[model samples]
Target: MIHEIAPHVLDNQFKIQDPKPNDYCLVYNGSKSLLKKEGNGYALPTVAEIQKLGFEDFEGHYLLNIDERAFFLLAVAEDYAAPEGYEFTGNRAFRPMAPVERLGGATAAHIAHWEALNKFCGKCGNVTIRGEKERSIICPKCGNVVYPRISPVVIIAVRNGDKLLMAHNIDNPNPMLFLISGFVEVGESLEQAAHREVMEEAGVKIKNLKYFGSQPWPFSDSLIAGWTAELDGDDTIHMQAEELSEALWVKREDIPPYATDVSISCCLIENFRTGFTLPET
Candidate 1:
């Protein structure tokens, strides 16, 4: 749901160019991003504000083109502090910002994290330089190129008649209920990953797998693929103690309250709760 920035287009074509006065500057320190507090929300800094910071010789990457304007990502030192009226916020806490601002900030954070992690070439332990033509860091000695890593994840809603499966992750600090989700392992297709996750976490077989949608979840650089499936055999849920603390099926009419505008998982759950059918693939 974070990618659904309607009215404002997002173009990620790699371009080597300098920042314009109207362009946005996404400054980041490790996983946190610098955002200036507007009246009630936060916003990215303009090129003028960045220029006032006096950061010279910093790494910059063309992240995306939003509404035909460029947005560049700049990774700053961890000790970098925000000027007056500005504050640093982690990428995960971007819900308070506008939809377009949140999307841009997430993308910038992803690139910044990648840049910080790959400052030195993993292959030869030599300092790497930014690639001039693409979004990558190239090692001058070993010629090893590193790009942003995106892990594939699957979020599925298991259906059985008018009921849907829900679970609470053992590691999640929030008590909000969520659908079964897991990362795709090596040598597994998206559908395979979906079924594997449901079975492993909920101890139930799922079939009739239908692709729902996808979202770029930059919390940890994940591309979430959403799906809907039907419970195959038994509905008895033997929750995986390590991954889930609770796993159960709930009737559609009895579905609990959840946020639908934030993530794809919430969207999937909301669709089922409201009886919104997906178009055939």
Candidate 2:
């Protein structure tokens, strides 16, 4: 839902250029991002802000653009001083950020993470170079190329009669229960992933897998495909203790409401509860 920046379009066509004065400067350091302090909130800084940090001719890595505004990643030094009114904050602060800014920040963070992981070539162990014509990393020695990683994930809402299935993942710190979800494996389809995830996580067979929608979840470098399915065989819970803290069925009226409807999983849950999901076929 964070990508729903209506009226403002994301122009992701690659362009090899340095940041201009008005372009956004997306700077990341470890788990934190440098954001311009805007009164009580934060915002992406302009190239001019980074210029004030003593890098007058800063050459930045070009990221995508929002509307007509370009964003660039600035690789700052270890002791990079924050421009006055700009602060470094943990990336978690992105959720409450304004929708447009949130999308930009999250996307930039995803690229930063990918860039960090691909510093060396997996094929020849050579230091990689950023591709000028596309969003990719290239190894100079062995010519190995790595694109930005986007793992496909399926988030399924399994319905049994009037009840919905939900589970608590062992990894999530939040106690909120979510729909059955997992990453698609090699040589797997989205539908296959949904069926396998439902059975593995909740120990239930499901049918009538209907396509819902999709969202680019930059948080985990995942493109989540939303799905709705009917509970097929058993309704018993054979919880996978290693991955799930809990899994169970809940009546429509009993499904816990989410604090914020800002994710694909949240959208799927809301649709099921409101009876807006695809009709049974």
Candidate 3:
């Protein structure tokens, strides 16, 4: 849903181009992004703008463009002091902005993480450089190439006649419940991952699994595949204490709305609450 910015095209094709002064600059310090304070919130700073504030030669790696406007992921220092009228905010801050900016911030964040994590070659312990022909990094010593990683995840809504399974993970800061979801492990299909995740976390089997939809979850560096399934056996939830803080079946009417619908997990839960049926899937 976050990437559904209609009429705002994203040109992700990699090209060799240096950042211009007016082009948008994306800078991050770990999990927080550096942005100039806008009217009520914040906006991305440009190369010229950051340079004017004493960050000289403020160039960055060229990322994709949105609607012909270019974006560069800037290399920033570790110790950050926000200039007047500027601040660094977490990823959630991008959610409330207009769709175009929202997508920009999230996409930039994803690339930033990829760039930060893969500073050297896995095959050879040599410093890597950006690949010119693609969105990847290359090690000169070994000629090893590394592309941005996109991990696959599965999110499923398991339903009985009148109730839907819900869970609050142990690591989640917000206590709001979510559908059964987890990363797809090695040697597993999306379907197998779905089944295993449900059983491991909720101690239940599922039937009538149907493809719901998918979303690019940039916040977690995951591409979430959504699914809908029916409970196969008992309704009693033998919750996995190590994985979840709470897991239970909530009646359709009792399932509360999630704070945002920008995720596939939220869509799965909302579909169950609305009594959706599988269309011959």
Best candidate per lDDT, number?
1
Q: How far is each candidate from the true structure, as Cα RMSD in Å?
A: 2.3, 2.5, 2.1
How far in Å is the alpha carbon of 48 misplaced in model 1? 1.7
Q: How would you encode candidate 1's per-residue C-alpha lDDT over 140-250 as one tens digit per residue?
A: 999999888999999999999999999999877778778999999999999899989998998999989999989999887899999999999989998999988888898
Worst 10 residues of 1 by lDDT: 53-62
lDDT of 3 by residue, 78-162 (tens): 6877788888777776777778777887888888888888788889889998887889889999998888889999999888889
Which ten contiguous residues of candidate 3 have the minimum total lDDT? 257-266
Candidates 1 and 2 compared: the better one by lDDT is 1
Which residue pairs in model 2 clash with each other? none
Model 3 misplaced stretches (Cα beyond 4 Å): 18-22, 38-41, 258-261
Candidate 1 local lDDT, residue 79:
94
The candidate, 1 or 3, that scores higher on lDDT is 1
Candidate 1's C-alpha runs over 4 A off are 38-41, 56-59, 171-174, 256-259, 279-281
